[model samples]
Target: MNLPATDRRVLVSGASRGLGRAVAQAFAANGDRVAVHYGSRASDARLTLESLAGEGHVLVGGDVSDPAGAARVADEAGQALGGIDVLVNNAAVNDPHPLATTSYEEWAEQWQRHMSVNLLGTALLSHRAARSMIDRGTGGRIVNVGSRGAFRGEPDYPAYGATKAAVHALGQSLAVSLAPYGIGVASVAPGFIETERVAHRLVGEEGEAIRAQSPFGRVASAQEVAEAVLWLASPAAEWSSGTVLDLNGASYLRT
Candidate 1:
């Protein structure tokens, strides 16, 4: 089964680093035109764009949480790539807060940030992308990079978990609402991804514990998660919509 996404125009948020960067690279490798979005790091976004194997990879910068910024991304992506065929909302903010020690201010901040970028921003951009697809009169794909925390609560990050749960719901809602227009929406949720940001949180014994919890006996690589993202947006997954695909190595099963 060859997974070729050639000629597809994909907009990937938070592509300056981590899982977003990996996914952007994956799409570029598959010969898709990619618009790589970065929130704050222009240098990093440039680096990611330069590293792509394809010629059409472009860097876009914005705080997607802002409605104007989200719309701008859609416009730039559409213009640069000749209109977006795929939208991957992979931007997120994660800061741990245990309930007992969590402050009200901190909780509010987390919720606001998470909802702004992870939920609202994603929704707005998806809307814009869908409109473009509708105008083209051909079905398109929208893939939300969600977290396993959506299904199972994270003891230290209630706000983050709740927002991710909302992401799942948002994808489902968009799926149903856009079905008539030939647009599909789905989410890919992964657990304990191995990235530089998570390295400090999981090391030595703790890392071992996390590995033991997963059926694969290890945390997932960014490439692994990116592969799943590619699949969800690829023609291979055309029949899948409103689906929450779990790529967690069966670490936390939903019942």
Candidate 2:
């Protein structure tokens, strides 16, 4: 069975700002009730919640990196939204720890952090949401916010790249496993996106270089990525499950 497009309950993790916020707004604009989740940015999350286009939107907070916290987040969102028809796994940690300059301890810590949040967190949440979807006997969608770095590489943030690659793989695995239960799973691999956190990097020489990476000579807006995600979670996108749609403006091509 295909999930309903509108009036669905959506849970967008790490939606306090940036891409996640844009995704939440898109779903709300499409007539879906959204649960805007935040890790430690309650104030920012409130701003996102206030900016939403409709009512019935809520705010949920928890540390997705922890198993208990992940469970709580999924449970609270499920209860508040009535049931999770769509889940966007957007929460992640991307810290730089270049091998040449960073100490062994720092490298290990970064690896663990990336693994816990980017990989484990997404897996745990997907499991919970999938089980709920199974119980409801209704179709659902899961869209993961993967990164271009998963394929393009991140020398300074190797852990981020590695974990995101793992996320992509996990999404594919779940797509197959959940197909019988009518849960479609997919991921988006976006290149340099223009967000508040990365505003400083989009100026001067660094900014120019980043933009030049794309054939369009500009980076993507959060709204652009959100639109792709919105479609991925739509009823029409069920066939696109297990696919990783790239939104890099011709920046990175994979064979």
Best by lDDT, which number? 2
Candidate 1 lDDT, 69-177, residue by residue in tens: 9999889889988888889999888888786887889877877887898888888888889999888877789999888998888888877788888999999999999
What's model 2's lDDT at 68?
96
| Alpha-carbon lDDT of model 2 | 0.96
Worst 10 residues of 1 by lDDT: 1-10
Residues 1-255, model 2: lDDT tens digits:
669979999999999999999999999999999999999999999999999998999999999989999999999999998999999999998889999999999988999999999999999999989999999999799999999999999998899999999999999999999999999999999999999999999999999999999989999999999999999999999999999999999999999
Question: How displaced is residue 204 in candidate 2, in Å?
Answer: 0.5
lDDT of each: 0.87, 0.96
Question: How many backbone overlaps does candidate 2 show?
Answer: 0
